[model samples]
Target: MLETVTSPTLLVSERRVRANLERMAARANRHGLALCPHFKTHQSLEVGAWCREYGIEEITVTSLRMARFFAAGGWQKIAIAMPFNPREIGELQVLSQRVELSLFLVDSKGAAKLAAELSAPLGYFIEVDAGYGRSGVSWRDHASVRSIIRAAGHHRFRGFYVHSGHTYDAKTIPEIAAVHQELLDRLGELQSAFSDLHPIMAIGDTPACSTQEEFRGIDRIGPGNFIYYDLTQVQLGSCGLGDIAACAAVPVVQHKGEEIIVHGGWVQLGKDSLHLPSGPTIYGRMVLLNQDGQWDTSRPMGTVTKLSQEHGTIHLPESLRAEVRVGDLVGVLPVHSCATVHGLRATGDTRFLA
Candidate 1:
C-alpha cells in the first residue's frame, strides 16, 4: 500500500479527526462555550477548513506566523494564544486589519507598550497561572494580573485565560478533574476580586476539557492537541488509543540484529516524549498499517528505541520484527502531534495519507 510513497509522510485520519472535533464541539455547545480549537497542531488549510464544517470559527494560535497562515486561509476569528510578540507586530497588525484579533498577555511589562502600537481594535485576555507553574501571572498574584489588564486598557478586554497545562500530568480522569477544580477555584477568586470588570473566563487543556463533563463557566475552550491525541494523552487518560488522528509513515532503512531503523526521526516527529518504565523512549511507537490505512492496533508493532535527525531505530519483540521487513512502511504515532506536525512542516517532509 505504501509502495507509491517514498518519503516519510505525515498522515491524518479524517474520520478520527472529525470524530474528535464533533465530540469537543458538542461539549462546548452544551455549555454555550466557544470551541476555539488551536490551529498549531494541524496547520494544514485543509484541516482548518474541515474544522469550519464542525461550526468552529474561533481559533487559537501560538505564533504570529501561524496567525497569518490561518488568517490567509480566511479564519475570521483568531486569538494569538501566546503572549503578544513585539517582534512581529507588523504581521500581527496585518492580521488585525483582516480578521477579529485577540491577544494573550502574561505580564504588565509589555502591556502598555503593546497597547499603544495597536493598528486595530483587539481583544486582550490576561493569562492567569492556574497553579501550573508554567507561564502566566500567578493566580494569587492579583496585583500583576490586574496591572496587565489595566495596562492594556486601550483594547477591548475579553477576560482572563488559563492554560492548565499541568492537567496533562494527571493519570486519571479524577486527577484531571482535580486540576480543573483548582483552576475554577482560582478563576472564581480572581473574578470576585475584580467583580467590576466581569471578565469572562477561558480555560483549555485536553486532559481537563475531555475528561470533565461540563465547563461550568468557561466562555471558550482552546483545545488544539485533542484534534490529534498523542501517546501522552492516552497515558493521561484524556483519550483512548483509537482517538489519535495523526501518524508518520516512514520507510524501513536498515536492520541491525534486534533493531530496525526507519527514515523518520526527530525531524519527522518532534522530540516531545516520555521516559516510561520500559526505558527512555525517544520518538514514538511503531504501528503496522492495515489495507484501510489505519493502524492495526489489535497487535503492537514496535516502539522507537532511538531517534536522530533523519533516522529512527525501532526495537520490537523478535516475533514482530520477523513479521516486518526492511523497505516496508512503518507508521509512527508521535508522542506529541503538535510538535510532530511542526517538525514535519518545518522540514518540508510532509504528505497526506489517502
Candidate 2:
C-alpha cells in the first residue's frame, strides 16, 4: 500500500500550524512582546505566508540565502540570526536595499568595522551569549560589547538578541524559568547601560518560551519549534504528544526476528538520538498506523532500534510484526519535527499529509 506513494515529501497540516501560531501570538501579546518567528526551521514560503496571516511581518532567518528566498517571496523586516559572514556582505547590501536588514555581531571590533562599511541604513543586535556557549558575546563581557557598540558609531543599534538553546536540557519548569530569567536579567543590564538605544531583547526556543511563565523585557520572542512540536517537546514538558504537527509514512519492507524492517532510516528521519543512560542513541520513537492515517499506539510497532543509509530496522513484538507485511505504510513520530521536515524538499511527496 505504501509503495504507491513517493518518498521525501514533508506534509504539514495547516490546522496545526495555525493553532501554534495563534497560541504563540496570544501569549506574546499577553506579555507585551512582538512575535518574530524564525524561518530557518521550515523555510517554506507557504508556511511563511501562514505566519503573515497572524500579523507577523518581522522575521528571523539563519542565513542570507534564506533572507534572499523570503525577501523575494515578500518579507520586509528580517534579522539574519547568525553572525555576518564577510563573504556575504554584497548579498547583505542587496537585501538591505529591499528590506530592513539587521546583522548580528558578537564582538565589538569586527562588528564595528562592518557597520562602518555597510552601504545602506542597517540595524544591529548585540548577539549576547547568555550561557549557551555556542556563539555571541558573553553578557558579562561588558568591554567587548562597549567596543562593538562604539564601533557601530552611527548605525541603528537595536539592543540584544540571545538564544538560550541550553534551555532545551532543563529538567523542570523551575529550571527553565531560572535560565530564562537569568538571560533576561543580563539583557536588562545591557539595556540600562545603553539607555539611548531602544532595547529589543529577543529570545527563542519552544521549551523556554512556551513551558514557562510570561517572558518579560523581551521585545520579540522567536519560537520556531512550537509550530511543529514533537516527541522531544513532550519530554521537555513544552507540549503534549497531540501537538506534534509533522510525521513521516515509511514503507515496511521486511520482517526479521522480532523486527519489522522499513526503508525509512537515519537519513530520512534524521540521525537524532535520545540521551539514554545505556549510551548514545540514534533514530526516533515509532508510531504504528491504522487505515485512517492516525496514530495507533496499541503495540510497540517498532523500537526504531537500528538504521543504515536507506533502511530502518524496527524492533517489534512477534504478534505485531506478523501483522505488518512488506509494502505496509507505518507512520513515524519524529524525535524532533523541525529536523524531520527540514529534510523534505517538497510537500506533495509525503503520503500522511496529503
Candidate 3:
C-alpha cells in the first residue's frame, strides 16, 4: 500500500481512531458529563460518522462553515465554538433554521445583534476566558457576562464555553491538573452567580480533558484533538506515543548525509512544531511504514527537523539512518493533528486505512 503513494498523503488509522473515540466517550460517561466531541480535528464526514458510532449526538465546531458541513452530514445539535462574527449573519441565519444551532459570544453587542437579526431561536454560550487569554470574556468580568446573557434577548442562554487552552503550556501532568482545577473553580463561581439561568458549563481542550479526571462543574466535554492524538499530546503526557492515529506518508526524495529530505512540508504538515527540551524544535516525529500501509510506532524513525513549502528535512539517528532509502515511504506523526488535518484537507489528499 505504501508503494502507491507518490506524494504527501495523510493516512488515518481507523482502528486507532475508534479506540480514541471509545476512550473519550467512556471517560465522559464515567464522569456523567455530556461528550459533545469537537469535530474540527477530523473534518471528514466519514470521521463524523465514526463519532456517531460511539453515541455522540452533539458536536462543536470552530466555524460556521464547519457547522454547515456537519449539519448537511446530518448532525442536528451543532455549536460553533468561535466568537460570533457579525459578518456571517446571513450564513448563520440560513444554517440556524436547518439544525439546532449554538455559538459563542464574547460580548453582549454580538448577542444583541444576533437576537435582533435572527428569529430562529438559537442557543448562545458566553465565551469565558479562564487563562488562555486568546479569546473569551474574562472570567472575572461578571458585568460583561451578565450583560451578554441579558443581551441574549430571545435566544436561549446555554451557559459558558471555556476552552482552557493554557493547559497546553504546562510542562507536567500535575501542572495541567492544576490549571484544570482552577478552571473548574472559576466555572463553579459562574454557575452559582447565574444559577437562575441554569446555564450548561461546557469545557474543552484536549490537554485538560485527557489529563484531569474530575470535572466538578462542567456539563459537557467538547475536545476535538483527542480523536487524533499527535506528537504534542504525547509530549504533554495526555497520551502515549502509540495512541497517535494520523500519519503523513511522504515519499523519500533524497538522502543528504544524516538528513533525509521528503516531499512533505508546511503545505502538507502545517507549521506547527514541538520545541524539545533538548534545544531543538521538530516539525514532526517520523515512524517506519510497514508493507501493510500501517506505521510501526514502537520503532520511531526520527524527527522532522525542518519543513519548507514542499520539502521536509528529517534527521535520523545513526543507527536508523542507514535503514531508509530515497524511494521509501516515511510516516510523519504531526506535531499538531488539527493543523495537519486542515493542511491536508486543503490539498484533497487524505485517505483512511480500514
Once fitted onto the true fold, the runs of candidate 1 whose alpha carbons sit more than 4 angstroms away are 278-282, 348-354
Give the best candidate by lDDT.
Answer: 3
In model 3, state the lDDT of residue 262: 93
- Report the lDDT tens digits of candidate 1 across residue range 44-109: 898898899989888988878788888889888888888777787776777788899888888776
lDDT of each structure?
A: 0.82, 0.76, 0.90
RMSD of each: 1.9, 2.7, 1.2
lDDT against true structure, model 2? 0.76
Per-model TM-score, in order, reads 0.94, 0.90, 0.97
Q: Residues 19-138, candidate 3, lDDT per residue (tens digit)?
A: 999989889998899999889999989989999899899999999999999999999999999999999999998988889998899998988998898888888889999888989999
Clashes of 2: 1
Tell me how far the alpha carbon of residue 248 in candidate 1 is from the true structure, in angstroms, after superposition. Answer: 0.6
lDDT of 2 by residue, 82-150 (tens): 987877777788778899988898776667567667756689888989899998988888888888888
Q: Stretches of candidate 2 above 4 Å error?
A: 1-4, 276-282, 290-301, 317-319, 346-354
Worst 10 residues of 1 by lDDT: 345-354
Looking at model 3, residue 72 earns an lDDT score of 93
